[model samples]
Target: MKQIRLGLYQFGDRLIMRARHDWIVWTLVTAEGQARWREERRFPLTVTAAGIVRDLLAS
Candidate 1:
């Protein structure tokens, strides 16, 4: 089974943050945390359009 850990951090302007450990995935749904990842702007490590939509609907 796959496990995911989500956390929040301080950053600038985005909406979520994703982090991974060993084989587990984590998503930090917050403005500051998201902003940090966005500013980095990396592809494979970046946010997914579909994921954002799914999260919105779930929320």
Candidate 2:
């Protein structure tokens, strides 16, 4: 799951990610950049997307 999601931030100068599910929501922000929300159709995917959005928004 982490491997696939890594693609989303592959080009960024820096990345702040969130891991969803039973694990704690981890947010590490080093920059204040813009982030767009992506609505997902799959449950597992959506969890990841929303987590990313929250992580970015928190930045």
Candidate 3:
């Protein structure tokens, strides 16, 4: 199994979660940013927004 890691940070009022495999990056933003990501990016559903990102990257 490959190890998956998540990087977290806070910018302004939003929490950003990044899932990276090698050089590819999938960004998941939460709070107000999540709302915008859902609207504009059509984010997938999961237990949480961050979970969705984690799962996507793991796959």
Candidate 4:
């Protein structure tokens, strides 16, 4: 199995996740931030980042 590592940080009021694969950095925002973003457009609230990585890996 290959090991994967992620770096997490907070910027202002947002949580950011960063992972490096090869020479590229992949960035993802916490679910709450995403929700707020959607809410700005009048979209319904949805899942957060709490279980996002697990859910994606399980799928």
Task: Give the per-residue lDDT of model 4 (tens digit) for 3-52.
Answer: 22333333443433333321222333554554222111121122344346
TM-score of 3: 0.23
Candidate lDDT scores, in order, read 0.40, 0.44, 0.43, 0.35
Q: How far does residue 8 in candidate 4 sit from its true spot (Å)? A: 34
TM agreement with the true structure for every prediction: 0.23, 0.22, 0.23, 0.20
Give the least accurate 10-residue stretch of model 3, judged by summed lDDT.
35-44
Q: Pick the candidate with the highest lDDT.
A: 2
Residue ranges of candidate 1 with Cα displaced over 4 Å = 1-46
Cα RMSDs of all predictions? 12.1, 12.4, 12.4, 14.4
**Total colliding residue pairs, candidate 1:** 2
Residue lDDT tens for model 3, 1-59: 22223344445434334433322233445556553231122233454556668889999
Model 4 regions more than 4 Å off: 1-46
**Predicted candidate 4: what Cα RMSD to the true structure?**
14.4
Ordered from best to worst lDDT, the candidate numbers read 2, 3, 1, 4
Supply candidate 4's per-residue lDDT for 1: 21
